[model samples]
Target chain A: MKELSRRGLLGLGGALGAAALLSACGEASGSASSDSLSTPAKLRVWFMKDSVSDKAQAWLKQEFENKFQGSTLTIEQQEWDGIVPKLQTALASPESTPDIIELGNTQAPTFCAVGALADLSGMKEELGGANLTKSLVELGSFENKMYAAPFYAGSRIVFYRKDMFQKLGLAIPKTIDELTAVATKIQTGNPEKNAHFSGMFLPGISSQSAFAWVFSNGGRLAVQKDGKWEGGLSSPESQKAIAQLQQLWTTGSTTGTITDSTIGSQPYTAFNTGEAGMFFGFNFHLKKIKKELLDAGKVGYFNFPSPKGDAVGNPFAGGSNVAISNNSKARGLAKEALKLIFSKPFQEFFATEGGWVPGNLNYAAALGQDELSKVTIEAVRNSVGTPAAKNWALVESAKVVDDFFVAMGALKDPVGLAKTADAKMTEILNSK
Target chain B: MTVTSTRAKPEGTLPDRTEPAAPRKRRRNPLPYILLLPAVLIVLVDMGYPLLRQITMAFQHFSLEQQFGKPAEFVGLDNFTRVLGDSAFWLTLGRSLAFCLVCAALTMAIGIGGALLLTKLSRPVSVFVQAAMLLAWAMPVLSSLQVFQWIFDSRSGVVDWTLAGLGMQGMAGYNWFSNPLTFFAVAAILVIWMSVPLVVFMVYASVTQIDESMLEASTLDGANGWKQFREITVPTIAPVLLLVTILEIIWDLRVFTQIFILQKNGGITEQTNVLGTYVYQVGLSGGDYGVASATALIMLLITLLLTWRYVTQFLKQGEV
Candidate 1:
């Protein structure tokens, strides 16, 4: 037994030595030809999942290679949540930095303010400068200087279980109050046959999204007062909106608060299981839901009702923005790539293949006649981006976003809670 | 009483204790220490450095906003005081202890019982039982947890289906995680299932060392089965049992991935967070490293205090 133990120890020592030697050799080889590698004029591009989906990505990669010829463009796929930290780390070191990047339109103000992005003031004329969405272009600007070009943008639309609603004898709601009454009735009716079936899935974790309802009701999240920003959540208009949402929860929500930011498994599962009747999601959600409900003829899309009973306003626009990174070694090449991205061909590809409303509104009419495409195009036009702020990224990092939603979800008096949230937001905004 | 005659003439320091052995011309052989240097270096670099850095970070107002910069100040003991006073901290600590204790106790009971049963069985049967334990131990925790999550899924889980099949109307398809009792029950069952294999293996390994004659003598003396086990088996495996219990307690306290994944699936993060996941949420997600470090140090202190007695007892048993 002792001999076997000693042999085992010797064998372990040999294995460790071998591993160390192999690693050392690998490191040595990598460093040896480092200087011979053509000065590394490579363009690094980071994009989100569907910002450039498979077809667009393949076409763009091939096109960029053919155009740039001498320079290499490396594309990276990053999830929306991890982009902030990844950018922070990448920006800290010039070597690790990307050349061209995609930013959420809401996130652009902060990045531009911090000077983490390259100012696009010079590239204005080349990037369809005059034709971009005015609000979106303004969002990417700090001190009236553009830092990013408008990329993809889309708005939230109401998707419903059509068959379930029909079975419940519920007509489509045209106003906020009417929507609430219908949701309450459907929740009580439990038309889907599952006791757990809910009329809406307003997850507590998605406070920012839920705030869109308040905004669509002519309630702002914050307002600037004498050079000081004050939160608008405590306003009577916002409270009324929140109260309407809370009434739905009180009548019947899912067993717990569901956050739009997090769907532990898959968000579409709620619809797939016939548990949820309606969800306020972006245009891209149409692609994820359409196939699942197509066979049953169960799913249908509509715009969220406006408080004025006329039409939806400021419907929570979310999408990606294309920008040239300040830290890139291949800035020239990356600028060339951005040109290709904004071109009519690429923008049309975004609409036709990727199911996103291209940043260029002109391409909306070109998306072929399909139900999903038509609805997506309509959602894009009515969408509103988040309020632009210099410290918006910091606010997200402070993790108050989750807390604000959670408090709203659990509050007995949502009006009072919104007041508290406003106070918290002011503190956060003023801290900068 | 007689004064011994010192052969040397000098009174107080006679003969210099056999000439002091001449200081032995010491040869500084550093080979053994050099042989141990890698292990010591590994520990210092891998474990000690990170722990020291964590301690330093606990004293600062470190945040993601200034993640790359120097901390704002060295607010001595302020982070500790703030964390200690937080109500959420106390609640989380209570939950962690309850979870650990329950898991540890259950694992010990099942493990020791299985070991005892194996001892009474034939050789082949015992081997088969041990093989089953090996398979359980080999199964990945995440894989098993994923299976359990599906089985308990509120909508289409098999458990709810079976209940409904039996004509249990209201009870069928219940979301096990919605209620606190069922959440802890499912969590405890998963933890205990994953932990028992190790406890069983350790006890079984130690049990083989016990003499058969002791059990035989106890049986001949007309002791009952329970009495024989109490008199013979329990004492023999007491040290192994203690060791396994201490390990199980530590493992259960730090359980993160299972609960994190389960909460993600089950919609129970607020209700079901333990120390590991809570620290991760605060430090990484919340971007408050100072608070996380304080919380982590508190967890370390707690585990140390809880296991101090068992560790000392195990050491004493080793000496015996």
Candidate 2:
């Protein structure tokens, strides 16, 4: 009986050990060094969803492969939802890291500071040195060394239904207050008598779109004073912006309840469904609007208006930066492919096909001289960017700003929430 | 049963000589040890390594910089101190505990009731119900999450449509994920709905093994159905119940997927965070690995402490 009990105990111990171990598996780490320029190697490139047009991706892949016979270049499209964490893990080891990557311009500083990307300082002149977007260059550089290169730039434009405006005898709003009044008028008018109609599809979770109000009101998300970063959401200018936004949420839109990021990012969806009179979106969302609306000349767009009916408003600059991973085994080959990505044809694709301001300002003329393209260029010219802090990506990941705006949209106590959010932002920004 | 009886006959006859036979049994045998070596080594390499690394990381200042190539400095309980001092950690812990207990209780109650009902149903009906439950259990979590999101969607969802149709005008365009209370309510329902089937299967299997003769005798003695169940069925299935309850508690305490996915749709992420999501947000999203590891270690201890009594009672029963 003693021996039997001891054997049983051994079995039980083994079972428990196995059960506990099943929960976690360590990530494998390995290093490789293969820098031969002539050797044929498969190069993998990662582009964010909706950032690169299919034509651009295909042209780059073909051009690179043609330039280097026997080498294959593959483009993998990744989602933006959790790209930061995914990059953190994937970029840690040589075996798993993609050779080339496209990250949000805002996220470039984080990767650059952490030494996740190869230094591009030597090729700065070769890749458009002075012609690259100025703000993007500032963001992609760390300690005076450039890492990621600006791929493209864009800013939000307000897309409104001309038919609705004509029916309601409304003209294009020229100021922030006038825009709110127009949205409210449309909401109350209910021209189509649709249930759940939003005059402006500005969801609380679309914090990027909401940034237009703050920026146009002379407010910033964060500001550096005496080399110390402080949250700017509680500033008087920002408080005024929040008050105006709250008023819009209360009377101008019913989409304040939308919390899903997917729906928040795609403002054109509600506009296409006829549930919204206007939406703040990128120029590329033009393709997403219904063909019927476009054919009927019902769809129109304009740059975000200023606060006092002055010049154009400064909306958040929306764009991406391309870089080569430091861990790539074929560093030489990756740089060659990156050069192809910035060539005239590939760069023009950004303007012509993707409806974006090309990173190389020289090629932006390919976007044509149409009214829409002119407005898009003007918006991008006046665009503002987030604080160029090293840890700004961490704040984005923590969703502090997004949550603050979401609370305001819900009509919560904005004063208390803004103070709390600012403090959290300060702590994270300063953390080593 | 026949094999045990046959073997016991010889032991019964030689009871006086058992002491002498024990010496022969005590002789060293390497076969069992050799057989266990493969599994033991696999467990150590597979699970033991990660656990050791996590424990070490909990004591060090590890972050994204350290993850790349920087040397991690030993912090020696600094991570623990910071996590414990933070008010957010305490709030998350309290919320996790409340959510876990509520989900486990609801799952168990409904599971047990379903199992009892199955026992009284006709054979075909029981089989149909069991089959339906098997499908629900086998469905992938992501698929179920997609369906549940659709059902509770703020716009064009069946729930709001039905409520509005019933003349609740305000129910139109109601967002379930905007408010924290409704956010958790939806998450709890999803967790319980997915878990109840397993408990039902386990309890039903154990309850069928109960002795029919004892139940018949109690019935003959004019005992009511509830009285017979309390007297006989409870004791017969006590072991299974104890095991199931402990497993449920552990599983629910560390629930991550349902809550994490639902939180993506809800705007109030901080307000709705439980321990699992909190750790993920801090470590993966916040890029602070040290504090996350410390928090996870604390969570593991809490789970073990909560289940210690039941685990000991189970081992004692096994010994008997």
Candidate 3:
């Protein structure tokens, strides 16, 4: 009340200012982001945390710098959490966007559908053509245009303590039931000695690992029919898988409630410390175990086994898809870098250095005769992917599978939770 | 990058009023308005544009498609209706409000108590305490969260070890983030720990500003320490108290970094999500900006409602 004169004056000024601001915003024209710049001086790229091997980074930098002299290439590492929002805002602006980026395969569709990536359909042959990881290429495409090229891929295999297995007179499980039985026997036999020991460290929120259980049992997360997507978790097959996983949780896993990858009760840490007899982890986890454990010849791994006891179980194909940013000024250089990433020398680093199956199948055989690589290759060949729904990224982001598995860990009614979770999955997958 | 708008500039750099002018504008000189040109324009462009954009998006059918320069259709109250109808929204709001209130109350109590203790302490000790509080306040949230994570880590946390040593053997290797209740408890402790310092500093500064002679008069008049504190000290610092309270409420209501970071480590996202994280999940993660904006608008209103009383009191005190 005391400042009415000033307030009135300010209000009048603000009204005029608002009129000016509205017109300014209304005139922000669309930028031509996809145009290739001629000989850009600097290029920026982003790689996810720990996604690329150091050797590959070194090779990529040296080669890119050599190919484009007088141009500087910068590689920034990004983290998985909160990256969607970061990418959404950053990729929308040409000035803010990186020239090249490595996208998580699961998140590729969202950016692809939204036209946040440059169309790479014309460069398919240059990007390894038939040698690309089939599932990733399928995932990174939207409306029949390739936006992201398949990068390296990896699949989870079952890692176990060889010493403990021999001491307990257990065989490498060839069937899903035998796997559970072996785990239960080991945990039951030595409960008094190791109070917090687990036969297998299958955390509840590890949806990537838990995905094996669902896929191996012939259950789909969602299915499409006549331009509509519906939840398949309520199906008998999924329920059976959920039941089997819950049984494993109750009987064989002491780390059932552990949720994340790097947290307490992490599979690698537990296995290295002799707290776990088995764990389902990516192929690289063998190297992550304690050196002493490796020196003791205690570590062994096998492919996730099928129910019929003869073949490898279907694993979730985990990987990244390298793409040039849609807003990048140096698309020509970025395309060269992308092509280089798919080349034999660069692709071989995935197997030789990173412990992953190369994105190019031609180089995947370079891992020739290594025990772990053979298992991973077999697993990758048998891998199943999340449904290629346009909104599947939304489903992953929503954490429906993680929630469902965590509920399972808490010993909730599996059938009911799966049904409820199924509905949520359907809702997110069909939102588009 | 382009500066092509006529509204931002006209004729020359300066407008001429020396010649003929409209009758309404003749009495009022436009010099003050011209003086405010640069600052006002900056504010209009910086804060005004996003505020307007958000308000526009809140009513539109905005999603992935519309994000890429595609035209959005006006959806009226659809987003609001969907958010209101969802039971999860209500649950999350209730939890978030309760969490905010509890955190604010605890922070204020600890802060006020610390301030009182500081007033009674020797100069050196008080300075040391202030320094420690400042350190806690100065620590980056991400680094502090990492420390909290280490402290509550199931496998090797000191809290778990100490609790187990005290004969709660079952607490050994206890997962603090395994369940929702435990997750919130840990998060609340972290939030309160980080927030209490500001309240302490503010209350302490205000208490020191109170006239000592007034307290001496009250003491001589048979007013005990508690009595004078309640009668004189309370009334004198009431403005600062309300101001701090208002700020604390706002900070607590929008608590995001701690909860968001912890969610990435463990706990069910559905169980642990507060309004901030929920909005982020829907808008950015789930790619539904319309619902997220509507949710955020509702959250803004709720915050306003909660802080309205304290804010009005503070403003009134300012006038007096």
Candidate 4:
């Protein structure tokens, strides 16, 4: 009983202190995070790991110091997976704000929409002006103003096993049917190597890659019907694309029981392991394939064939976008950092070292590094962005997304399944 | 006799001493609670505050915009109504319930069997068994999850190779995560494997505390080993078993890291998702805090309902 009393007093005291601290931290009117200084001398710039490769770090450091003479630019490299939550937490506190950050190109709209990104309309010309890719910029725009600058563009290419294709007596496919035929033949011919081989590694989880399919068939994800966003999944072109993709999953691709990409399997991993005859992945996969295989000669690359004969490869262009934080203490230094990033010298490193096509259109010459570079560059040039809609993120994160793809993988009737999914997608998209 | 007792009071006896001698000088000092104050402070600051904050946030129409200085509008039960109406919330809750119950039952069964086996073994053998269980228990969830993914990997997992060696044609490197059953099986197996050690330890400790005289008495009365265990040993460890069961249920219900990591590894996020992972995906990834928090509170309510009996039993035992 004496022990109980002591424990009770201690618990009460701790609970009181905790409640007080919580209210102090959570209350909007609290001054716990306020700063008296008008300007912060040191600007903290948080970027994802591998965004700036080792080769460009030296040049970037010198440029930042030279550009912003008295101040310092502290670059904190964060991993891709943890950056979102960390950014959210930092954005919630004025004291922990970083001056600049890099967001995934697809995720930029959500951040911009949520008021986490600074308005970059003032520093437009200094960053890139007319030289930036229009589609990439559109992804970062909200309410008729740009919030982010296109940092890099990663385009997909069809990486194939050269020897396997040669053994099957096939040339690089030019049309969607030809590619499907090649994958089928290769998968069927060599049962030993091809039993586990997905003739093509098109993951059900990869909606971006899947979107490219629908778009290449001339279907938009959303159409401006009556001045409001309406989903296009039920359209004839989309149905046609879904039907073809469903057919691929039924006969040409691996069983749903074999591979799932959202579970973390990379298209490149299968291709490198020789378990896939063909794969569609970023051109950045070339380095990984080279490192894994130890010899780059064994692999070959080609453009994703269109349904139209010999038309340009049109992939879903994906990359990171650079943005100044809305809560940033030093916007001037961040702009200076952006100036260096946009320069010819810095942009060239993206291709030669970083394996990304620079967002600047003039840096197209960087594609001379490898044979696959040209195919990927062409795809990026002709690529389409996800529809500029407010509810795109909501639709992407909806439960129906998985069910829709799983149904496709299960070989459901494409038209019926797509129509059902379209209704759900529209519901989520229409949510405020 | 009264006269003789009064004669002894003339010595060094100071009156009748009716004050109870200050509780006979208690052995344990009251200051130990003071020593524990720091740990209590840390837990309240780190864990207790966040939980209370989460509960409060559940009622507000909060968003990323309100994370900084913007005030959250109090919406009463609207968030709960919205979440309870969501089709996905119900689906995920159903999945979580099924997964947790199955995992908890399996773990308890396996743990009890393993504990009984340990008792029958020699000291060295039992120690080695305990050590093995401890090793698995000590392994980090993420690292073991990675191993599990590789073990079930379609292209190169050993499960497929063994299946092929058995003359199964298309069973090699099976993507175990795509199917709901296979995904749950894999998740359950990992959870059970990780949790069995704690249950085993608790059962073993309680079993050892059973009086040897009771076992001997049951045996001498012509009862067999199994009969003695059922009548005497089981009753002796009943409370421990109940405690372990309650804990296992709670742990299984709240499982997040393993499923989340596996989803990240296997790309079957939608199909393989449980309540904890679903909450994170919706709340953090989808930025739908209202729905996530409401779902979480519902999970808490479900847990409370399920464990109410055990809690009452424990409280009754405490009073006794």
Candidate 5:
């Protein structure tokens, strides 16, 4: 038995040595001529699942293959929830990295700062020049060099049951306080008539929606003060906003425990059932409501109300940016693909099919003559975004804001929770 | 006596043994070693390299910069120190232990009961029961977890609706994943449901192999079923029980998918983290592979300590 075991160990050692030698040889060969794309190349593009329209994907695939002559572009769809880790590891490896990649506007800074994307500053004029989404441009640029170009933009709007509002004798709220009163009346009256009714389905886990309240009230989640980041949740403006949000949670909400993220992705799911009277969601969410609800003209969108009752409230802007991988072997082909992506025909698809505000405003003419589009454009114009800190994505990933709001929903001490959450946010945002 | 002598005769060993001519080279048999090569190579590559990498990562500052082709600095015990100093790591460790113990105990108790019941059933019934359990055991974890999520969904879920129909109005729209206790309860029930089948199969196979004559003798000695099971059946199948228990403990300690999946919707992140999910959060989400590796090593040591007794017993049995 001992002899057999010893022989097995010897065999294993031999096999491992051979495997290591083979891999070493492979690496040596790969580095021999690594600077340029070889013939018959395959360009791998990773686009998030719901970010881009299907027509755009099909067009890009056909166009890239047609134009490049010898290259193929494969668009791999990725999910947003856990993609940061996937991107970090994938983009770090030259062999594994995709040729073309899409970055969430919030996540672009991290990649750009790490030098994971090729420089796109030279394409500024060719892409869109000053017509790109300004916030996305800011996010995708590092040290005045653009690493990503704007792809599309979206912002949250209040989607209400217009029919229900008239039934309840409530007018569309014009101010934050009036909105609260409407929500309270609807919620209290909802349960008395319907078993599972909610005034506005503002789930506690939906921190981004809650941030609209904070931003409109002139509150920041975190701010760079004295060359260091300090969490702004404890600021009076933020506290007041959180208190209003807390009031909505206590008086206007139905389910306080489940996260809004779960509902956010499919906001129409609840509203379509006629159980939810109002919902805070992106403009495209209107297209996702049940057919019966749509046919009845029940869904109507409006910009969130300002704190002062004088203007549209600013929301947290959400969007995507496209960039080529720095380590891509087919960077030349990827650039050609990017050019195709930014062309007028393809860019207009963002507004025409995907129902998003085109990153290039020139194509936004295609979005003309629709109430949803009008409200969405107004919401997008009025929206503010997260601080341009490289580590804000980490804070979002850590769920600091999400937890704070969810805790607030449970009627926990808003002051105490905000203080604690602020300290955590400060630790993370400054950890950069 | 004549038959025994004939069977033991030297002539009997030589007859029909043309291979005996190569007896001198028999000790150098290459066939068995050749057969073992594939298995040994698989284990060496699949298990050995990753373990080595994990240990190396545990001792180094392997963060995003290192991940992106920069040189990884080797910092002796820094990762360990950070993990040891963090209160959250300790919380995760405690939660992991508590989850494992509870899940393992429940799995074993139900497993033993099912195995006992199978023994008393008729042959056809036993076959049908075993087949049903095998189906459950065969289902993939991902598919089963999704089904469980649907079953307990806050809205339109069957569990809530049924409970509400039973006059439990509070459960009508009860959000199960929101609460840490309820979330783990759902996870535990799913895990136990998936794990019991294997334990039942193992215990039943061993129980059927128990010496029937010994059981008969015990029965004749006026011992009851419970007493016989304790004194005779348990001792006879004690080795299998030890092995199954050790395996269950190890599996339970590394519970990941159920908790991770539920946490996606639960949003109770801080309160519900276990060791596996905590490591993932730190390594991937936090982008700190160094501390995650250190935590993983600590978990490995805990599992080793837990299974050490049974492992040594297993080795001793092999020796005997």
Candidate 6:
């Protein structure tokens, strides 16, 4: 009898404890509003790695704090990997959510559509008006309501070794086919006689880099038809691009089998080793190039060449979009801080310090009139973006496109793989 | 006082004095119950809440919208039916089971062999081997993953370098992670390597505790080493072996870090996903919390079923 009563009491205690905890969780979720514009509330902002330069970060903090007396703004750096899941959980609660978050441009539509971000339709004109990057603005909107603002934009460009070109008596490639021919010639020539040399340091896992070929050939990753999204990899233009990319993998590059994204991002590593004659990378990667190579005038840049040589190829627009979480307690204060972020100094810092095309094109003049800047601005101008579908982030997280290209890089049967990948993409894109 | 006297024995003995003590015992002291309250509360709050939430979510249509304050509609068996109907889930299940069995078997074989060898080694050599195994076991998973990635790297990996130097010129830049077979091979190697030390230590400790007299008795009966082992050591350590095997099966079946980190490096994520990563992909990455919860529940049932017989036998032995 005693044992039974004790067990019952223990069960009752557990039930009471669980009930109390659940009620506590429920109570904390009731959001507190910003009492006044100048109220001293500490704001937390999350920025992705490598997105904001240290100088820009410090300046933003200092400027925001100076403007809003007694209120502290704390900036936390976040990694790009696994950030989607992190945001999904973090943005659900008032206490856990950062006041502002910088998500990848491709991921903005997901957050925007799900109501995780605060609607910024009223402040759109005040932020950048029509001067904001159009594609980014489109990606950061859902049902005509703006949720995120363009942070900055950049695109890949061909960075080749001028010494290698001069040594081999090769002219700058003017078209897609010409680029391939040049790469093949360099690979066969092996001017440095390095056994591990590759004409182009293109890794298969760098699906964003390969997007240049697809977009240049007038193909998209996905397209909406009759209000239903369909995968575009099996289209004629995409197939042709894949064939050309496979040709490059077979004859001009030995880095196609590389599946590591970290290695994919660092194309200049092989270039620095004097083994890679050329690499496709961001203008920001210029800072990462060997100083000796730059001083010797061996480094040169070019926009990705088009197939017909009529225009620059459309590389993927790589950038971020900043948004305030809807769950943020201090929405008004966050808006004020966001105004400082879009100010002239902060916008110009993107060009002068970070080597990215600023989110606002108005401050692009600070990038200087150098050839490198011209190519970078031109690349960003012609750049394409991933599908703005609401579930595009899910597709990316699933890595369907990345896996398909990795197989293509391995010289697999592209036709079958493209069919499978297209089906997967379509299924994911149309899924709720 | 009359009621107490009626409850007690009427004999003029110690029983007459214990009647007062019996009433004292019935007074119900609250100290023990109070002492248990905090522990009970902690367990309920920490583990019980998440479990309750997961079970409830399995029957709901939960997604990112629902996660962000939207109403989640209860879908009854929809999530279960969807997960069970998917071919991908079945494929992942088969792959996970195969990977788990292979890894567990290999780890057990190598661990048991090493433990037996330890019994034969000198004290200093045994101590050195134990220390090395301890270090390997204690090394962080992330640090080991980084080293493994470098070793298997396509461009400058030592594996490719060594293979190329051995006249296998075709392997000079062979990408280990590009192929699914080789990807799982690397993952399985890592899983077994990380887990073998624990198994070795456990088996060794138990093996040393076996009675030496029984082994000598078997040997005097003209029994060979293998025969003595099968007759004496096997039965003596059967319970420990069973427990370790069950633990290995569970650990390997739910192996996450090695496969997940390798899949990130490798491009064959879909082909290489085990059950642990599959749940993560479907729930966290894919944002289908309902279906993921259902799949996780199914995985739990399968694990329970797999270990049910052994667990029962373990309990029976404990009772004995």
lDDT of each: 0.69, 0.86, 0.80, 0.72, 0.81, 0.86
Give TM-score, chain B, model 1: 0.87
- Error (Å) of candidate 6 at residue B270 is 0.6
Give the alpha carbon lDDT tens digit for every residue of A1-432 in model 6: 344443444334323322222222221132565636867889999999888899999999999888889999999999887888778778878878899999899999999998888888998888898999999999999999999999999999999999889999999898888888899999998889998899999999999999999999999999999989999999999999999999999899988888888888899999998989999999999999999999999999899999999889999999999999888889999998898889999999999999988888889899999999999999999999999999999998888999999898889998899999999999989988
Residue B105 of model 2, lDDT score: 94
Interface RMSD of each: 10.5, 4.9, 7.4, 6.7, 8.1, 7.3
Per-residue lDDT tens digits of candidate 2, residues A197-311?
Answer: 8999999998999999999999999999998889999999899999999999999998877899999989999999889999999999999999999999999999899999889
Ten-residue stretch with the least lDDT total in model 6 chain A: A19-28
Per-residue C-alpha lDDT of model 4 across residues A1-432, encoded as one tens digit per residue: 444443344334323322322232332221332122334357777777767787786788777776656767778888765456556656654567787788877667777777777788877887778988787788889988999888888877788878778887989888777777888887777534544567877777666667667778888777767757776778898777777777677666774433354432367776766777777888777777746454746688888778976596567777888898776666666677777888998898988888788878788687685567777778887787766666566555554555566656656667776676777667756655
True contacts kept of 2: 0.41
- Please list all clashing residue pairs in model 3, or write none if there are none: none
Positional deviation of residue A251's Cα in model 5 after best superposition, in angstroms: 1.6
Q: Per-residue lDDT for B219-272 in model 6, tens only?
A: 888999888778877788887787778778777877778888888789879999
| CAPRI quality of model 4 | acceptable
Q: What residue runs in model 4 are displaced by over 4 Å at the alpha carbon?
A: A1-44, A65-86, A95-98, A161-169, A191-198, A255-265, A273-275, A290-300, A369-371, A397-403, B1-44
Which CAPRI quality tier does the interface of model 1 achieve?
incorrect
- Stretches of model 2 off by over 4 angstroms after superposition: A1-32, B1-27
Q: DockQ for all models, in order?
A: 0.11, 0.40, 0.28, 0.23, 0.26, 0.35
- Give candidate 6 misplaced runs (Cα > 4 Å): A1-35, B1-37
Best by TM-score: 2
Worst 10 residues of 4 chain A by lDDT: A27-36
- lDDT for model 5, please: 0.81
Model 2: colliding residue pairs: none
Model 2, position A281, has a per-residue lDDT of 97
Docking class of 5: acceptable
Off by over 4 Å in 3: A1-31, A34-38, A264-266, B1-42
- Tens-place lDDT per residue, model 1, A140-173, is 8889889888887777777888887888898888
* Cα error of candidate 6 at position A210, Å: 0.4
